[model samples]
Target: MTTQDWWRGAVIYQVYPRSYADTNGDGVGDLPGIIAKLDHIASLGVDAIWISPFFKSPMDDFGYDISDYRDVDPLFGSLADFDILLARAHELGLKVMIDQVLSHTSAQHDWFLQSRESRTNDKSDWYVWADANQDGTPPNNWLSIFGGGAWQWEPRRQQYYLHNFLASQPDLNFHNPDVQQAVLDNVEFWLAKGVDGLRLDAINFCFHDAQLRDNPAKPVEARQGRGFSEDNPYAFQYHYYNNTQPENLPFLERLRALMDRYPGTAALGEISSEDSLATMAEYTQEGRLHMGYSFELLTNDYSAGYIRSTVETLEARVSEGWPCWSVSNHDVVRVATRWAQGEPSDAQCKMLTAMVCSLRGSVCLYQGEELGLPEAEIPFEQLQDPYGIAFWPNFKGRDGCRTPMPWQSEGEHAGFSDASPWLPIPESHRARAVSQQDRAADSVLNSFRQFMNWRKTQPTLMGGSIQFLDAPEPVLLFVREQGDERLLCGFNLGDKPVSLNIEQLGSAHTVLSDHGLREAQREGNVLAFPPYGIFFARLA
Candidate 1:
């Protein structure tokens, strides 16, 4: 595949650094540790690896609050370590994509420190700084995704700075050309390092409404959205003025133009806004992001109708750009746990793995997803994520999914660390360790590998046009057509068997089925699918 098209329908495994592996016994994962595990990742049949943030930071939001973009945090090893990791990844036939958090920077960053010094300084306008209202209140009614007000008073500048996330993560002033150029320059630094792609973090948050207008409130009855939970006040407003501003398009174009200078490089954007799907369509159009993904599939909603509607909506809106689908990532609960309602069975994991991979777009498989690891139970005192700590008991934060990977079932700490891990590794996950699954042919890990490898052989699945068929509840039927190859994919998401007449599907024959996930049995013109079954068939 060409560099430009390698990501299309590619399976990109997401590795959360702090929880992946630790080489120095620091209880934190580092670059060298990732290099050591490159073989394991390559064996999973993934096209590329998207490593989460490991940049220099104060750990306020872990590595998301980047203090230095060009260097790796000592906690994650040095720049040289990254170079070795990238080289090894390439040698293993794996493209490396690093996370780039361009929307905000840690308050301790040198640029923010300089910008906050004085209003007359050269860097004064680097960040979004606004004057307080006459009543000494915040400039607007904006609220942070983390909690409380979005604006924090800066004593040095005697003004309030905007932060859509944590107060320590100040939003950048993308309206300023210089700021945009600086952000691009930082991006160029990574591109020059030989990374194949960039996973742009919160890409839509790159620009904000210049007017600083207060966002209109959403009716309590209509407050349901994708990213934030209903409990978060950030979801109370429509989030019009703070993010997904139209001004973000030109900046993205500018960034895309820079990527054009380097052939074979790609940009994948992560968008979260009021209408994330629309924003994804807009941000990824021609000459902008190469692929865009949102939190639509990551939410708690899991049904045939919701899944079909989300994919069909994106397929309708995103005509020119590509879509990257992910069922779980570092920020959300593991799909097996989130969608399962209770404990997930092997059938659920295998079915979800096949279904997500069968989608028309590229796919992101989180670190331990292959092993069917459920969300770890994290206690309040053990929680490290501030979002979880701030809203304890009610939300329990993201630490459950961010815990260390269980490499071995018998190790002191599942081979994740020599010292105590940053977050406790649950025994449930330990039981699903890689070593344990590697020995079981019918394990979820093996099923994911088998199906992913088999998927590569089916061109219809990779670049075909998807057409969803009308199916009854708990049954999702879709056809993927590419030139002479037409494939029909069907899934029984319900707990009971379902039968479908394949008479209209045209000469259908079984192509593949996830390991032991019951394939539909065809009798004459009818197909009977067992509970949690998945079937892929080729049409004449």
Candidate 2:
């Protein structure tokens, strides 16, 4: 495929910076560390690498609360190091995409500092600030995603500043044309630096209800578990007024227009909304975003029906727009453990990988996913995630999934650091380290490589029409067809064996299997699948 079309249905690997690699021995992963590991990432046959935020920050949200948009954080390294990393990634034939947190900024950000200093400052209107109500409470009843009221009283301005997430990370008023322009300038800065694309953080939270109205509470019946904890009062309201407002569409158009100026640059937005799937479809429709993904598959629902219904719903809703799919990321529990019934198994990991790649969208593979790593069981004492600390055993936050990438088996801290690592490297992770898997041909890492390499050879798998097949529960069956070529992809998401009639599917050649299990003989018409088996075939 041409470089321009590289991300179309491509697999983009996500690397969480603080846990990916720590080169300077400061217990934190840096750009130099990422630069040192580009070869290993490229060897996976992924089309691109989407590194999470490494911009200058207070790290209240671990680089998501950006203090500076133009330069790399001192903790990560300098702009020169970033340039070196970008050059190394391009040399390895990998496209580089950076996370852009445009919706909010650290309270320490110069703009925010100025905005919060006084009411009459030139940048006072840059952030979302409003006067307190007569009762001396917040403007409205909006709750922060992190915790507490979304508005924080500013003593200097005698008003409250809006924060959709953590109070330290104040929301930018995209309603202000200047704020939009400044954020776009940041985008231009990265594009000028030769970055391939951006994974826009909380893209839908760019705008809010102008009237500062209270959001209506979601009825108890409608409040089925949607990933956020009930402890986080943010889940109580429908979130109609705070985010995903209709006004956000024009800003997306403007952002897309800026990205269009830079050739081969794409935008994959991260949309978290009450109706995320519907919003994902809306965001990627026409001139808005190139593509967007939601928390649909990121949740704990591992059933075949849930996966099928989510994709089918998207396909039906979004005809003109493309979709990007991911089973796990930094925010959710690792799929290995989330889907694991008893003890974690490599077979289940391989099945999950196959299932994600088989879906009809561009894929995003998180760091350590190739190793089939389960969520690290972090002790409370070692936990750095405030969210985890707040919820304790109930949720465990996201620190478990954000632990350091295990590079070696025998070394201290899994060789992720010569010094103490930022987050504790789980003892369980050491067994699946890269060094151990590098020597084994049948390792989960090798299986990932094989599946991805094989996937690249098929145009149908790359970008094709998906047709859900009539299959039993726990067995996801679909056909990916492009022009004259068609492939039958079947996955057994359960431990029990399942069977389907391959003669009914016509004569076909078995092409790939994660278990290395050959297709069973077609006894008249039925073809059987063993536990956790995956089968890929092309019609004869």
Candidate 3:
């Protein structure tokens, strides 16, 4: 791939800055710490790094609530530190993509501060402000993802402002042309700073229904939508009027236009709507987002059929855009724990990585995923996420997945920090630390490195069109072809072994190893798979 298209089918490593590494003994990771750890990230053989939010924020949503778009948060170092980090990453042949939370701003932001002070203020219309009913209720019945109503009562303006997320993270009014221009200006700041691309946070939530219509109620049996579970009241409604509005497309085009001005810089949007897959298709078509991904794979559904149907559904809807697939991120439970029938095994975890990477798009591998880190069990007393606090034991929020990375087996707090880390590093993770894995040749971390390095040698695996083959339960089969090169890929997602007859090969195939995965024994049309086994064959 050329410099301009480097993101196409690229393996992007996601680094949640708060959990990556802490250099200032402040119990939090920073830009300087990420810079210090660039060598380790580069060793993983990923094409780029996608750093989570580190911009100036109140840390209300753990840096997602941006108070200043152009400056780095004091908790995560300054602008100078970021520039140094960016330069160091480039020197190590790693592209840098930072998170851009454009849909909302911190309640403390100057724009919101001024807008909330008085109705006649210059920035009054900068946010979504609407009048309440005669009974003094909210303008609409939209519920916040965190909990409660999406509308917050601003006493100064005597009106409710929309906030699809937390009340502190008020949604920006894209209806205002000035707000649109201002958002683009903030995005241009980083692009001008020589950063490679942006991971747009909730890009579809930029515009709301101008009519302020109420969302339709979902049936009681309906459990989830827009990545929220039944535990969240936000899932009770269809969320039609509050987000994924048609007006957002023009705004995306405007954002795309800015990114085009800076060559080699792309936009990877994070989408979640009523129908996230369909929204991803619409958002990335034409001159909009460069690539898009939804939370379908991030959910707890782990099966061969579910995975196949999800990708095929998106592939059918998408015409001119690319998709980015990820099984693990900073949200929900880790893949090692979520997909495991019981206790997760190293072999199963490695197979999971290989499985997701084999899909037909770019991949986002979250930090600590290489070590097959299971989700840490965060006690209620130790929980920091407000969303988690609101949901409690029934639905433990994202704090479990947001714990600090384990860097060493013997060091205090796994060498993540000298002080007590923000979230406790699970004791189980110490055994899977980077230090321990570096010495073990058969470690999950080592297998990850080996497979990624090998994947680079196969052009078909990188950017090839995918065709999933029909197979039995716990077995995902597919064919990836680019030009004359065709490779048959299969994964046993279950814990136990199984034997199946796959006549799809027609016996004209070569069993290819060297991906450092468990092997599959073949006899004529019968192939036997071990626990979490992988099969790759070069088809003639």
Candidate 4:
């Protein structure tokens, strides 16, 4: 692929810095640690690596609340270490994408600190701040994703500061042209450092309703989890005033314009809004964001119909825009545990990976997903995630999926750290450690390698339009066709076997399968699939 087209149909691996690997024995993963594992990432056949935020932060939201946009956090490493990581990653033929959290910054951030210190300052207008109501209440009824009201009382300024997420992560006032320019400056800084792309965090929340109007209440029956708790009261509102403002589109265009200056640089906007899919379509359309992704597939709902509808809806809505699909990430439960009842077999893991890659547009594979790793059961005492701690049991937060990557089963902390890991590596995960799977031919890791390598050869699977076949439930069948090369892909989502007519697929030659499928024969257009099976056939 050409440099500008590298992200098209590319597979990007997301590395959560804290849990990936630790090089300084600081019990946390760093840039050098990622550099050391570049070969392993390259072997997975991914085009790029999307490293989660490593920018200077107070760790209130891990690294999401950036205090310094242009520098790396001391906990992760210095600027020199980051440069070395960039050099090593490029040497391995892997593009590096950094997370850019433009929606907000740490309260300690110079801009936020200055804005909160007084009512009149040069940077005062950079953050979202408004005067309280006549009755000493917040300006509006906006609620934070972390819980409680989105408005934080500032005694010094005698005003309320808007924070759509955590209060410490005060929202940046993107309506201000200066704020947009400063954000673009940060983008240029990273691009000049030889970074390939950026994964924008909460891209839609950059602007909000200028009127400070109260968000209407969303009845309990009309509510769904917005990555926060139903009990948190944040979910009670429709979130109209705080996010997905029309003003965001122009800012996205400006951001895209800045990125376009650097050839081959791409931007993947994270659309976390009330209607995330619609916002995703809007952001990626035209000259706004190069591409965008939402939490539609990231949710716990796992069904053939839902997945088909999501892809089909986006294809219908955005003609020129692109998408990036991810089933698992730093947030939410791991796919193996979320979709599968509890423990998904190695076969199921391979099926999931193959299904994700076969979808149109780009793909993101989380770090430990290759091992068919289930969510680690973190005890309340061991939980480090503030979200999980706030809503225990019913809504166990993201810590389950954020545990350390197990490299060795018998070593200290599963070879994640010499000392105690920040979070305990579950015993269940130890069995699926990298050391145990390294030599196993049928291991999930090897399956991922083989399938990804094979996928690169099929242009239909890599870059093609997807059409859902008329198949029964528990079985997802789709056709991927690029020009004259068409391929029929079938995936059995359940243990119970189901069959489909292959007359629509035309002449077929068995090419790929997760279950070692070799008994492929055309019986007058009636194709048969084994239990929990997957088949890829090139249409003649």
C-alpha lDDT score of every prediction, in listed order = 0.90, 0.87, 0.91, 0.85
Query: Per lDDT, what order, best first?
Result: 3, 1, 2, 4
- For candidate 2, the 10 contiguous residues with the lowest summed lDDT are 513-522
TM-score of each: 0.98, 0.97, 0.98, 0.97
Error of 1 at 95 (Å): 0.6
Q: How displaced is residue 97 in candidate 2, in Å?
A: 0.4
How many Å off is the CA of 182 in candidate 3? 0.4
Error of 2 at 517 (Å): 6.7
- Candidate 1, clashing residue pairs? none
TM-score of structure candidate 4: 0.97
Q: Local error of candidate 1 at 341, Å?
A: 4.4
Candidate 2, after superposition: displacement of residue 422 in Å?
Answer: 0.8
Better of 1 and 4 by lDDT: 1
Position 223, candidate 1: lDDT: 79
User: Model 3 Cα displacement at 14 (Å)?
Assistant: 0.5
Among the numbered candidates, top lDDT falls to 3
Clash numbers, per candidate: 0, 0, 0, 0
